[model samples]
Target: MSNRPYIVGNWKMHGTRAMLAEARAIDRAAERLIKVEVALAPPSTLIHACRKEANLIGIGAQDCHPADGGAHTGDISAAMLKDAGAGFTIVGHSERRADHGETNVLVKQKAEAAIEAGMGAIVCVGETEEDRDAGKAEATVGEQLKASLPEGEAAAANVTVAYEPVWAIGTGRTPTPEDIAIMHRNIRAQLVEVYGEAGQEIRILYGGSVKPENAVELLSADDVGGALVGGASLTAESFLGIIIAAAGDDAE
Candidate 1:
């Protein structure tokens, strides 16, 4: 929490037991970098395995169901994720929003459920390429953020926001640092308005094909507390590079 850069890897639907080696390697590297707080949200199937392999780094789930239980088949609930050793869950990811047709209201419910189940919620909000092109990026993100977050101190304490433009995700394209900073500032303002002082401390991560090459500068942007990395985070080497970038400012 404490302003220490929170670098999280969203493995999405990829990874299996074979990838555990890479996760272990990432955990070993993370142990050496005390300044950065690293975590991985692997496929739900690997959450417990990853936790068992590495105690130093955090382990999370990519997504969770809003309901605690029922005949929701194929869907895992926040409580189930927690029981599986997931300390956090990423909600409202663009992929989930688009593929599953998840609405902001549903995202908000999932976030609240995560907190209720004793897990942190990394709520994602973003504008599609069309929205960005239309100069409604900030407006789109603002609306999503407002609708997707839960109220109260505990919710604020357990929530982190991520801005991953729909177009940029998995496309290797990213906004300039200035553009990132502007969007982050806008999101930060909204958080403050909603959560007051607590909002200022909510970590806002930038996720969009984040890679080692640009990790340093991107992580250095104003109000950019961390990153929600994609492909680059699949391996220990590349992911460690970004972790090292986060450690720079706090390196002794």
Candidate 2:
């Protein structure tokens, strides 16, 4: 996946059957933009629908339960997501961390479950605004990532790390390129410490307020392998712009 940007759209709680049109459009564009890796993690209800519409683009789930089969109510398991045609799943997203009170240990279990189900896991880690203001941004995120990541060498193959500042999501704010670079570099160092040489192969993506207008610059940051987009991904026009930016950046 070297030189190839993995641009993913996290539609969150949004999207219904009506949104399949946008998914189709994104898939068609992804087919043309072979230089970039494009994927979408729609709401669980739409995962099958999006997969049916997607050929080139990957279809994934927003989250998954760690248990393969459980008495847990209202939770979809990683195996279920795989059966629904999802190639990957996002775990430990900031919203999940905050709204659901997900801890680093639980996130790691979720990631391990995804890997066990034969799917990729994008484990998210980020610091809150307070942590950043207190000069603990790097330390906070680093610890979260270390604990949240799945164990074993398989992690280097099936896991991807996404850094999304909690305060930036949907707020239209973004860290400057230098900040992004610094955070990514710190994350890289941690990865290397944990996984040795194989860690360098793991993709560390930037998220939070990622739009087409800034995709190129954000993705150009050192060790920024791609992006985890939010609102802008709900539309083909806007999402395609970011994908195009990634393709252009790959060419460089």
Candidate 3:
């Protein structure tokens, strides 16, 4: 992947087949910006359709079960996501942890499943506002990364880590550029400790209120390999703005 900035849009629970137009538009724009890698993790319902509609931008699923197939009832497995044309899946997102009660062990299993099914995994880890206030933000995120990442070869090969502060997500708030730089540096150190030289190849992304206006500054931060965008990614115009920011940074 050349370590190009990997800008991924997580549509969350939004998007239907109707939004495929925006996805196609994003894909078209991605084609022109070959210096950056762009991807979208849409709701499961549109994964196949979006994959079918786009040829450039990577298509991914918002979540997936650890098991291949079973009586999990309503839960889609990693294999099914791959079958649906997803090249990747995002696991352990803060929303899944809060709303679905997903534990770190389970997130690790899901990430392993994604690797097993031949898909990339974007594993998320973050701290809450309270944790930040209590001066535990760094330790909390470091612990989550240790617990949530897959083991052995999968750890460095298939996973990308995203740090999204729970309070900042969808709240129109973000860590200062210095704070983001510090966090990413901390994450890079942990990854290197665990995976050795291969860890340097692992992409660390920053999420939470990543808009086009601020994308350049954030993407320029030390060790910030890319972004895991939220609302701003809903529209191609908006998402393309971030991608352009990344491309510009890469050029510089």
Candidate 4:
């Protein structure tokens, strides 16, 4: 429905300069990848260096401040990231939403900030295991989506929605195909409500415990445009496999 499905690798706090070897490898391996829009968010320290590498993949930051100019010490605004050649940014990642106490208001601000800086924002929303076990998964995720997502009127087309269940993220756990379907459907429904006709254009990605081995199947699911990969995305080969799988049907 959108221009192209995008697959994003969120390196989180896991990369160092040595990881550049992997980034380069991924770029080289992805030489033939055209059906999917591939990008990665490496550690902030490596953003500039990653940008200077091969040109196949998109480069983005983990996060940014809401304001262009700010008195907040240690805060990097969207303008700075844009100047550094970032084409995307991550907002409301589960860790930030939970650990750092980031609120939906804050996440919304950061998304707006990304638009201001000339970049796309990957906004994340999910539910904890407790919520899932209680059959409250949809309810929890719905609330988060409502607060975390900007109405189509509020945010531009540069927004990407990621459905990452906190229960499954990095815990070596994953949702069943049925569960994934329901959550994504709910997310899409909410987007339609907020964005109206424009909601069909939002790229909805499934994240959490995504690996090369399981990638293709995940990408093929209904409404699953791509993945917001974690652990498996650290390496170029592994990450590339996922991309290759996402582009499986398009193979010619």
Q: What is the lDDT of residue 213 in candidate 4?
A: 78
Q: For model 1, how does the per-residue alpha-carbon lDDT over 1-252 read when each residue is reduced to its tens digit? A: 477899999998889899999899999888778889999999999999999998999999999999989999799999999999999999999999999899999999999999999999999999999998999999999999989997655898999999998899999899989999999999999999998898888999999989989998898889999999999999999998889888995543
What lDDT tens digits, residue by residue, belong to model 2 across residues 1-252? 466899999999998799999999999878778899999999999988888888889899989999999799999999999999999999999999999999999999999999999999999999999999999999999999889989965787899999999998999999998999999999999888988888889999999999999998899888899999999999999999999999984433
TM-scores, all candidates, are 0.97, 0.97, 0.97, 0.94
Per-candidate Cα lDDT values, in order, are: 0.92, 0.92, 0.92, 0.85
Q: 124-237 in candidate 4: lDDT tens per residue?
A: 999998998899999998998888775444374888899999988998788877778888998899888888877888889999998877876676678887889989899887
The C-alpha RMSD in Å for every predicted model, in order, reads 1.2, 1.5, 1.5, 1.6
lDDT of 3 at 120: 92
Error of 1 at 20 (Å): 0.5
Please identify model 1 stretches exceeding 4 Å from their true place: 249-252
Global fold similarity of model 3 (TM-score): 0.97
Q: Which stretches of candidate 3 lie over 4 Å from their true place?
A: 249-252
By summed lDDT, which 10 consecutive residues of candidate 2 come out lowest? 243-252
Q: Model 4 — which ten-residue stretch has the worst lDDT? A: 148-157
Clashing pairs in 1: none
- Per-residue lDDT of model 3, residues 37-125, tens digit only: 99999999999999899999899998899998988989999999999999999999999999999999999999999999999999999
